[model samples]
Target: MASRMDRAQAVVAIGELFREHGYHGTSYGQITAATGLGKGSLYNHFPNGKEDMTRAVLAHVHGWFEDNVFGVLASKTDPMEAVDQMFVQVDDYFRSGRRLCLLGAFSLYDVRTAFDAEIVSYFSRWVETLAGCLKRGGLSAKESKVQAMACMVDIQGGLLMAHAFDDAAIFTSSLARSAKTLRAAMGDRVPA
Candidate 1:
């Protein structure tokens, strides 16, 4: 008999599968194969099955993003630098040859009903964190929130365009344009 797997390892494996194949596109069998766990063993950890596993994956991704991306972005005092670094972080993230965004991929899947609340709450917190950063950079609360939403849309769209075109340049250019626009909006108040 195989040794039992830990919850963290299972969650990480599920996240990798979800990242590669999306929620609906991935199967329980595939997850088991990927994790080297039997069905019963899988269920032992996630009794609710795929939905439960997916929820765990979403939470895992959320926490990872919060700590790595948002945490780093929020650390800098210069709002403009923070915004620029955000793009740099995103560029490095996608340039690492990972074509799919875990959250973006999950949103595309039919398993929407399975993780709706978790996904919504995750995105809401992301937006609020970004908007808060922009507000600190001298933008009005309303402006920051709207701009943050626009930035998120641009990122999603840019990723799609980059993948469709089979080019990273498009993604880089899109981010650069966004940074320029944001800097222009901030005017003299933008960090030196």
Candidate 2:
């Protein structure tokens, strides 16, 4: 159990590095330095080394989004309010767009084979949850799904822009627009 906990901590520590430098950019030396675990122990915990760590990081990211984002969306009874709360949660989670999204960041790397299916499922579940919320708020099924997809595109695009410009406003503004658009589908008047 102690080894399991140590491995979990190592995965989290490595995940933070991957979030900033991406999979290809992150190295075993860096992971060792970050976790203070020598090669022997590192390989002991992750027999497949970087590949294992990347998979663990992806799993960590997937679990976090499921708990922090989708869980909120699922539990809210008021859909528009749920949309509103989700944007707030997203804003906080991303640290106003300063924090890189591990899943989105992974897409830029050649290591997608390590966890592409999980990434797709994470994104699909996110959109499906949003679509369900929108449908609850009165949008037709097709419209709900379309708007959900748009929201996700805007979010990932916004994150890219935020990183490129070194500005949080880009992501925040896009999130606001996403929420407003979702609300508008419910015939709610969105403030300008």
Candidate 3:
């Protein structure tokens, strides 16, 4: 008799595969092979099939992101420094060891409807959080939201470009330029 796999293990395994190969690239067979589970075992855990498994992966990644990135931002008292630190953490994560942004990859996947709402909600929360940090740094509500969204887009776009080109330097350069632009926009508003 095959031992039943835990839900947490399955979620982590699926997320790792998705992170490496992306949505369209990864297959159920690959997942099964990674998890060392049979077809029936996979279905037993995720009755809704790949959609359910993807959702689980998203949720798992979201939690990990919040812990690593968002948590760092929220912990800092200085908003400007916090925002800068956020980007630093992002760069570090991507360059740490061939680590690509899972959310960014998932967003570009062709199966748009599969996890749209969840992905949107997660990103919306991230933007709002960043906007709040900007507001703390003296930007007005509208300005804060705009700056936050721009930063988010810059990071995601830079990462995609870097991944596509197989060049980490491109990502780092884009982030540096974005940081400079952001600081210049803040100008006298930024603390010494």
- What lDDT would each prediction earn against the true structure? 0.76, 0.83, 0.78
Please tell me which model should have the higher lDDT, number 1 or number 2. Answer: 2
Misplaced by over 4 Å in model 1 are 1-5
Residue 44 displacement in candidate 1 (angstroms): 1.4
Residue 73, candidate 2: how far off, in angstroms?
1.5
Instruction: Give TM per candidate.
Output: 0.84, 0.90, 0.84
- RMSD (Å) of each candidate, 1 decimal: 2.8, 3.8, 3.1
lDDT of 3 by residue, 1-192 (tens): 224457788788788788888887889788887887787878888998888888888888788668877776666787768778877777787772256777777777787677788788778878888877777677888998898889888888888787788887878888888787667666677555
TM-score, prediction 2:
0.90
For model 1, residues 80-161, the per-residue Cα lDDT tens digits are 7777777777777666333556777666677766667877877787778788778887888999889888887777777777
Q: Model 2 over residues 41-157: C-alpha lDDT tens digits?
A: 988989998888888888887788788788877777888788888888888988888887888877767877767897888899999998888887778889889999999998889
Q: In TM-score terms, which candidate is top?
A: 2
**Candidate 2: lDDT of 149?**
96
Model 2: clashing residue pairs?
Answer: none
